[model samples]
Target: MNFFGTIFSYIRETYVDRLSYFPSNIKISLMIILFCAIAIVELYIYIIFRRVIKANQNKQTKYWKERIGNMLASVVVYDESENTAEIAVHFYDKLKKLPLKNSTVNQILTSEIITYHKNFTGKIPEVLALLYAKLKLDKRSKKKIDSKHWETKIEGIREANEMGISEMAEEIIKYTDDENGLLRMEAQAAYLKLSNKDPFHFLDRAQERILDWHQLVLFEIITKNKKLTIPSFSKWLRSPNDTVVMFCLKLIDHFMQFDAAEEVQRLLKHHNTRIVKKSIEIIGKLELEELEKHMFEIYFDHTDEIKLEILNSLGKISSGKYADFLSSRIHSNDSKIKRAALYAIKRDADHGEARLLEIYHHTSPENQALITHVLDNRIKQ
Candidate 1:
């Protein structure tokens, strides 16, 4: 045993001596320096990510505040436009249909975050009109923006020369900031093709930072003024921020854009399940049956928020193919989702009454009242 112990000690010492030759002190110092450098890089990356996220969030918040103010004003205007007491009631109904799920301020913020930066045209008119609509509306005394990009806009204003194309340019400049979406789109059409065709030319350079402009411009180009809105809007649906995609779904209100169904399907592969569920829900909002398959998938997800959204949307729209999935969610362990399922079934459907009644009698009093509300709505319908 002693001999074996001596041999082991000798081997250990030999290993230690070999290790010592590696300059242990220098190695330790190098390791410490490397660790610190890695830590610094990690910290720098964190700070950058935080700053970007904060900036994005801040912009959204600002837009939200602007939207709430505009919506409130629009609501008031709508009330006065109506000659009767029903104006207030109609205005409330319209407000209810709006995509806003939170306070008007927060809803605007949420929409802005998902809203394309290039699409500022939609919101720009909101800001400009509000600024001029009422003195009470003017909060910022900031400098007014130049209506024209530069002297080209001024020179184009020489319609007396009969320069037809130049006159068109002038028309665009004049209405680029107009409250009307059609006019704004006309302005975008006057420039987009020509600008991209000869990108290096001065005419294109005039709108060099166009992509950075508020998405009101993009939306005008993509939606109201023309047919260009879908592909661009579809691109945004797969964006990193789910909020951006959410608003994209909201803006895409037309039936033709509903053909972009496949793009929304691509969103099911999104890393965030909330975003995936929202994409499907938006399809559901558009009354598209294609969203049913994804609805089934989202219904099975463990997330409460995603499940609730699916339940709500599926209950409203999923009729033929996705009904079974919606039925299964009624049996979900989650009381909220189950209650929502019962409510949706009761309102838009009658087949689920037996299941709903089973829960109505068996579930708690609060749940029973909710189920009763659904049944009452069904009776009224």
Candidate 2:
């Protein structure tokens, strides 16, 4: 053993001495090559480790999904018993015994349950809600609502809302005042879902501009719930937040709350151009003849956008009484105004075609072209 050790030491010393004699550049180059080799080995090991982890995760996901899918299928197909509540309890008991109740498994169950919950309504969804609550997934989601991560909290709110966890409404409402816009929107949607007693409660105090996408979502949710006691949207028409007022206008238009026609007429003279424009649209839709004079009164006090909207409203109203205003605009130097006037006139074919022919004989070429386009292109069926 001593002889072998001595031979090894001698060889290593000889190698080190030879390396020490190498020029500085060659030594650096060799050191770089050594480091590169080490990095490549480490990277290869890391890649292999990641692939192994991914494969294991995929295997576990498949296992849990299969188990959960079987449970869901049994609920929908195999369980012929009309008593879904009892079956939901029994299935939840079985679900609790499944192996590996980790985050991944929980996520899979959540996604699966949400898919079924959205597809069905009435007692079916109610039973699934019981299953979700019994599985303690609702508790997990509630815990996530308090998570330090914003996205996690949003996901928690969404899960609670989608699963119909009404108990979490107060907890969800706390985030409605969050600084993050997406988080705030999600929280509001959750609140709307869980708290149907007063769905638009947050809108009363909302400070931000409710985006168009958010409006569409809330509209769908509110409109679909037949049991909901929809309050008077006119209460929000005077909101200090323009977005709230704007959203209220849409609600009014959609519900066709003719009682709010008085308020809608008053808003036509609002200083905000959007409020005025939307008011015009709602007026036209409701066909509140009393509101026509308000639009005509404010016609010259607003911008071109408001002007076009007013003309559009006049066209929609299609009453012969607004013909004088359209006739006046037909002679204006602004071609857009002329087109709007022509459109308004063309809309009133019963009373305005004679005036259209009479104007064609005396108007500017631009006005005549516009008249010709309207009379030809906007033909009545």
Best by TM-score: 2
> Candidate 2: worst 10 consecutive residues by lDDT?
73-82
For each candidate in turn, the TM-score is 0.39, 0.79
Q: How displaced is residue 209 in candidate 1, in Å?
A: 13
lDDT of 2 by residue, 1-381 (tens): 699999878756644766688788887887787689789999999999999999999998898899889888677663444687787877777788865268888888887888888897666676788888888888889989999999999989989989878888888877886778899889988898898567678887688777889888888878997867888899888888887889889989989998898888888878788888999998888888878889899888888888888888888788889887788887676778888877877777587678888889987787777777888864642
Q: Name the lDDT value of residue 76 in candidate 2.
A: 62
| Stretches of candidate 2 exceeding 4 Å from the true structure | 1-59, 99-101, 119-124, 318-321, 346-350, 357-373, 376-381
After TM-score superposition, the amount by which residue 289's alpha carbon in candidate 1 deviates from its true location, in angstroms, is 2.7
Q: How many residue pairs clash in each candidate?
A: 17, 0
Instruction: Kindly list the per-residue Cα lDDT of model 1 for residues 202-231, writing each as its tens digit.
Output: 122222222224445444544554423224
